[model samples]
Target: MNKQAPQNSVRLPERMRHLAVDSRGYPVIATINRSPEKVDFGSISERRKLALGTFDWCAVCGMPFADELRWQMVFEEGALPAALSGEAPVHEVCALYAAQVCPFLFSPRSRLSDEGRKGEVRESVVRFVGFESTSAVIPHASELQPGIHTLAFEQRGHADEFSYSSPDELGERFADALAREKPLPVSDAEAVLVRLFNRLDDEGEGDVVTGAALAAGAVFAKDIFKVQGLGAFQGKSYPTAAALLLKGTEEQILKFSHDSQDEAFSAIGPWVLERAGRFPLALQRWRTRGNSMVKNLGPSSPQGPGRSVAKNAPCPCGSKRKARRCHPAGVQATP
Candidate 1:
């Protein structure tokens, strides 16, 4: 008998990056970005693409990850060796910025950029923050390209983040792992969170959402989008929040707070064709459009839009004879 695939299909690859491994090679460090389309860490040369190395600058702040600092990862089950390279390594502050305002950060199953597949009701996402283990080392690579691409590392003891109850606690322990590392001050972290929250609020400016609700969402996105994929909006959780943020569904949330994100996706239809999903359908629709270029260029126009037969035809205005016979020569004779 042949072996079967697991009960739940892996919709997204488990991208385990070793960007945080130290120079001495003790622990391995890594993190996962939610959607593959959102994964743009590898656009530069290997030297500039510091996220691929064991030590690199923070993607957001452009500072080093520091000696023995703990970082966060959101992941699911996959072979450890096959863990793919992930997004650019970011500062905890920057990651904190992203965690807020991102609906998909909270819900691992949520598709951040792909609105067509926002909450498809599959794929379990687990979140954790941890430090590199002491066993991490540089892995052999045949061709080292830049930014963030998947590579293999031989690090052990990183999965310990799972044992902890909260990522914050793990971060503290990660601080302990650093040589002479002072744990990131809680006040600093709190300050970062507050700054990120203000930014989210600023982003929601002209939307239909209420001011109070929007502010609440800023906190919720900061606190919750990283953990659960949803924060409260119109009495709903992950799905509603995702719909509002990604699909611009403020009205939809008020109309159907009880429905799931999958239902909303199905209902949104052609509005999403160009934005996400079924590109063939969008192309086919374009090809078969009622008033197309061919229709516009010819004289047999059902609607008055395109360029119809011009200067040479007999005037439809009923002077009857062809343009050359009737009036102006070589001018685009009126039909």
Candidate 2:
């Protein structure tokens, strides 16, 4: 599925990544990025190349790219380990694994060439350096404008000002409004998730969701996607929060529970593709995977939001009978 960019900016020459697992329980084929030009739904190709392996980094332990067998296996096709695939993006299964298995994955480097380290720091440390380009993005959890959202941030000095909405207009303003400064060096993004969760939990006003759990949920969701042949839905569609919750199993849902905390999320990634049902792109993939990638992830798995749950055998309502058998009266044959 292919979606158009924001109305303000022209579509960037982006790549499409289709992440999935093969037969073995390893994080292979992180994703397959299709050409942005491919827009048609039914005409899109089913087979494409893959990007495999977790992008793990560690200060003490180096990457294990030395083993030829591992290198070969990295590109190989297979299923992600059950633990890794619990509830994250299908493509990020390898990235989460890299955080655990590889010492050099996604970790900050203390020592480096000035330019190299600076570049790395810039990415990890995002200062709210004002708006680069204001365009509305589909509100993730907030109930607001659906059109282009502003892409404003704090100055270079503070990286913590990255907000989903325009912070300037909000009543709560930053200390030095529009200040420019370097952002703090962050080791792992999991901390961001932790902070988000903590803040939500602290509000104590509503359903509190932790940052770590969210990140882990995203990670785990992706894993489930890989196993379920739903990798094509990752970024192609814009799904709503409710729609995003449709993919995964009872165990995966438990993994992202509020109480799971940092420990459970230590090996998880963000489940950005949860909204596959909210948009047209993801919806198309949901329909295609049932026939194309069913062998790898299984059609029974909950891979999309709008998917007919009743068609999935063994109804969630606890009928103790296949959905089709118990509700054959409602099942409609596809012409």
Best-matching candidate per lDDT: 1
Candidate 2: which stretches are off by over 4 Å?
1-129, 132-193, 196-335
Candidate 2 lDDT, 1-335, residue by residue in tens: 11221211211111111112222222122122222232221121111100011111110111111111111012113332211111112111222223222222222331222332443431232111111111111112211223312111111111112221221232223222213112222234333322332221232211122222222222222232232222433442213222223343434444344334444233232322332332222223333433332232212434221345545566544666766556644433211
Top-TM-score candidate index: 1
Q: How far is candidate 2 from the true structure (C-alpha RMSD, Å)?
A: 21.9
RMSD (Å) of each candidate, 1 decimal: 21.3, 21.9
TM-score of each: 0.26, 0.18
Q: How many clashing pairs in candidate 1?
A: 19
Candidate 1 at residue 241, lDDT? 42
The 10-residue segment of model 1 with minimum total lDDT is 7-16
